[model samples]
Target: MRGRLIGQTVAVMAVGLLAAAIDGCSRRVTPEDFAEGEGATAPAEMSPQQERSSAQPTGAPEKAVTATDPGGNRNHQPGDKEPLEGVTESTPSAIQGGDSSPEPTTRVSRAQRTGGVAERPQGRPVQGEEQAGAVAPQVDQSQGLGDQAVEATPTVAPADAIPIDQPEERPQLAEGAAAADGTDDGRPAGASTAEPFNPLRAGRAGMGPLRSEGAGGEGHPAFRPASTEASHEGGRQSKKYDPIAENGPIFVGWPKPQLALVLTGCQNGYLEPCGCAGLDRMKGGLGRRHTFMSELRNKRSWPVVALDVGGLIKGFGRQAEMKFHTTVSAMQLMQYETIALGANDLRLPAAELLAVAAPVDGKTLFVSGNVALFKFEYGMTARYEVIRAGGRKVGVTAVLGKSFQQKINNPELEIIAPEEALAELVPVLKPQCDLLVLLAHASRDESIALGKAFPEFDVVVTAGGPAEPPLDLAHIDGTSALLVEVGQKGMYAVVLGFYQDEAVRYQRVPLDSRFPYSPDVKLLMVNYQDQLRQVGFEGLGVRPVPHSRREELGAYVGSQKCQSCHEVSYRVWRKSGHARAWRTLVHLDPPRTHDPECVSCHVVGWNPEYYYPYETGFWSEEKTPELVDVGCESCHGPGEAHVKAEMGSDLALQRKLQQAVTLTLEDAKKQQCITCHDGENSPDFKFETYWPKIEHREWEDE
Candidate 1:
């Protein structure tokens, strides 16, 4: 009882101190104030290649703030009652069997806005409180941060009197439940524990992996998150619980000032819309995204912060270079605050990756916290960046997936686990910003694990892994952390709505026909194509040979050659989408003809690196017109031998040609369609549904 009273006295003293600290704040700390500090030293000037090879990894810890947890040793074990709100206890010199006075325990509250922190619980909603969306009072992004600061109110309790409540059980939706809105309690629809990952249906039902932090036994200091709902300064409900119904206006009568966080992932070098799906059906692209964001800010009056969760480009090849440049340029126009570096980005030689990371007009900062230039000491990116948007300090950090790290393979680079990186990072960053966000380019399971262990993150945006339905708003189990992943191929951009005193609402905005193409982006795409042409990938189209498959295939004998003998099939090819594939490239904003990346898919019988080994196979469009536009040999075995056989009188030769023709058609539906109509190029592609569109029967035609 005496110990308890002592703890109470200490708590009261700490609260009084906290109140005094807040009272002295002269001005709001802006992002600009924190932006100019230290980061990984840019590699010294040298050949780009040498810069990558010579740079040593270094760890530069942020200036240390006194550690907040009391006693320095608060390990929790299994079976311990975890507090809903985390408890921080600082010991006084006297409590340690010393002569100094007892230290007070301080409870820090979670940030509720994109970058707004409250000294006291300003807009926190209690359990079962009904809140509705309201327009937040607007503030310019550049200034006026101090006026919006919420005065902190210290909630005092005896250090030892912390509540011992079991963590709240996360509610789960029924199997196959409609994922239209959030759950009964207004949390994102909790995914079923049993649902397997399905990327194609992102923004729907899915569950990431869950890992325990091994906080053990009784008295585990499990930090409970602040209430999810926002509360006004007066501690009253701000709005009623009235969600915009499905099919309702996306932004009709938003209550007050709100922050819209727009996220995209797994672009994979797809800069243009795939014509296979019409405007109505076509889902994504930088153009549509630009249009959507512009309208939201201009039409809805919502302050928006945009981020890309990585997987920006498909590869590091020449073609991807063009796409990369174009994509980055588009992101700049869209005003992306940050782009997390994904495994695909790392595939580029380290030097090239760094080149990509160089600030684009000082608008986007590419980051990956877990990837080190070498050891765990120093790493890629500035570790964390705080950017101001919506008049708040938004802190962003990144963690590249381990799978990508393994692929990097360079001895000079080291990739650490996300949890390990966050262990050292979050504490330092948490004190610096109002709201914290993580760009986690990892598997769904890994991202979830990160969230569970680190509840300080306000939002965890993830990418990579198979394309699943976009489940943009999710709460990590046992914590209030929100995890969202936008599916691959730029099909949809997930929008997370944040109101001052309401639960964050999430929706996937399909970037389809409704949004017009951004003219600036369109012009940018055209300029990229022109740049490609200037580099000599012109008329013949720069198609690289797939050196790995060289041993198994025969090639060449252009499409025209096949047409001489198989007129009906040639005509059919001309009429099919395959025939116009090249034209699609040609018609794109500025028309890209020589891009090795774009060429590989539009033309037949080659990859981006090398040609299959065949005496008369396609070498160039001028040299092999018959091999152009996804001709007969693209799916059939390369026609060099087959053509020779057809022209020969040998009985064996004739029989072989016939056999080849029959087998080619038989294999068409299986290997032929899927090879090109893949997830990245044609997400909606289904052979059964698509085959009939181009099916041409020789007999029927005759």
Candidate 2:
């Protein structure tokens, strides 16, 4: 596929060059023009005495002009028996050198010849003869298309024509040439080396090839002067992806990019995808995201402003606090400009969060419109923030959803409705900044509603709720406001390009196995983990026990143990989707099978501290291989006692096992499957639709 793609690119370039060469010969060059070295002389701009003496007599015999074809290798010289293909010799009325009887005139360009060489004087550069900073004059059809007409009338080019290609001897400095005072050579006089021209690189010069205006230049009649069209072609060549050329914004000319905003959301205290590496490595976390942002900043070298919808830390423990601090400190090094407030961060004590949220080196600001501590402290939480980026004032504000606001009841914290907060904040922020952005950590529907209500906002970035695919630039139907969202966790980052007087363009970059971890962030994670082991959760002022307190559920027995009686059922479970859920995480970078949030659905009977009930379940790899994924025990009840009772001589225990084991198909389809297959994890889940894929009850105990 790669080879085919490269071949296609080369083929396209070849065709374009062939067409350009043909266009170059639109007004053919003859040998008599080259014999006299018409195009080889210096500029024809001379005194009246010099011009009068150079004119030839009208009665002079015509010079023998050789016709060279622009075809395959071979020269077509004077008087070949077979005139060059599609070409016939003809002489001007005054000069008679060819056959007297009129021959058919073939209006063929020099490009039509199958084998012909270009005729020009030796040691003359094709592009250097034309005066720098001068436009080529319009063609005079009555005088014919050749060097004679151009030499007779010398003219200075327009101010904009070929300005950058002006010779070193020009009076004024050209647009792109080296400083006049610096060096005698046209290159920069200083020791600073000249860099290769790149359209995407900031503060660079020489965007395209220089050409004279109109069609005649340096004794060539067919060539037209370079314009924005050349710059556009140069831009297309510089980048692998040219959004402008690919049905995106149609830029009139080269426009400098102002700023690049890298956006993120819902980190959930994930230092790495999981600790595992190799094939099991998972994507995302601070390490990979930092790597992506840093690399992009270095390449573009534009002002990179990073914003997050928040939720950096997932839990309330010393580990979570340290992780949050580490993540924020790394973000500071990464040069993040602003971060919106999320409810997850508010779960921590006011003092700890305040210390962490404090401006890092007075650069990264935390913006929130509704979130406030102890009746809205100005220093802790402001209604909005105005920041100048790439010479433009940008306003940033955040609003937490009502669902999240209800989680905080402490009188020290005050949460206002997003609508109320925006009503007061929008008017002030709109007037202060060129672009206004609101971080709306709410449901998708709620975010859209906010965009419609506040058309003054230029962008709305949503966080929380079911992880959604990156959204396109969606307008409010009646307003100019646009809405977009990144998936949950730091799995994706939206890179936005801001240009002067143009709509913002964005690309959704997925932080997956393809991206590598930053060494600095990786080192930070290692140190944080080391600290975690030394001072456990209890030492960090967090409850060490699981959140779910339920203890009535039965113990899990290995699926292999069930094979003794229900051999067919075990085979069916082995082939089902549930059996390989753990491996799915293992295949992902950093292997997220160990992650509590991911493991809950992938593995059987997982119980994280924040949600769900605790039960005897798969503890670790070495201890519970059978309970690794959803097996018989996951859909049915735990089978340790049930399996033992059937094998033992206890009549009463066996009777209890029979009753507990008889779960109707409806029970499993309606409730058992829906538990883990709901939003965020599986948005398209339909229990009745999906149950048939794994339904296996053909075999039962006699």
Structural similarity to truth (TM-score) of each candidate: 0.60, 0.50
Q: Which candidate is the best by lDDT?
A: 1
Candidate 1 residue lDDT tens string, 194-237: 11121111121122221121121122122111221111011222
Model 2 lDDT-worst window of ten: 84-93
Per-residue lDDT over 133-248 for candidate 2, one digit per residue giving the tens place of the 0 to 100 score: 22223322122101111111111122233334423222222234343234322221121211112111222111111111111212111111122221111223221222222111
Superposed Cα deviation of residue 435, candidate 2 (Å): 2.6
Q: In model 1, which runs have C-alpha deviations exceeding 4 angstroms?
A: 1-256, 276-279, 359-364, 372-380, 411-414, 464-472, 537-555, 562-581, 607-616, 664-666, 678-702
Model 2 spans with C-alpha error above 4 angstroms:
1-256, 266-285, 313-323, 326-330, 360-364, 375-378, 401-404, 416-432, 442-456, 464-466, 469-471, 524-605, 608-636, 650-659, 662-701
Please give the lDDT score at residue 167 for candidate 1: 23
- The lDDT for every candidate, in the order shown, is 0.50, 0.49
- Candidate 1 global TM-score: 0.60
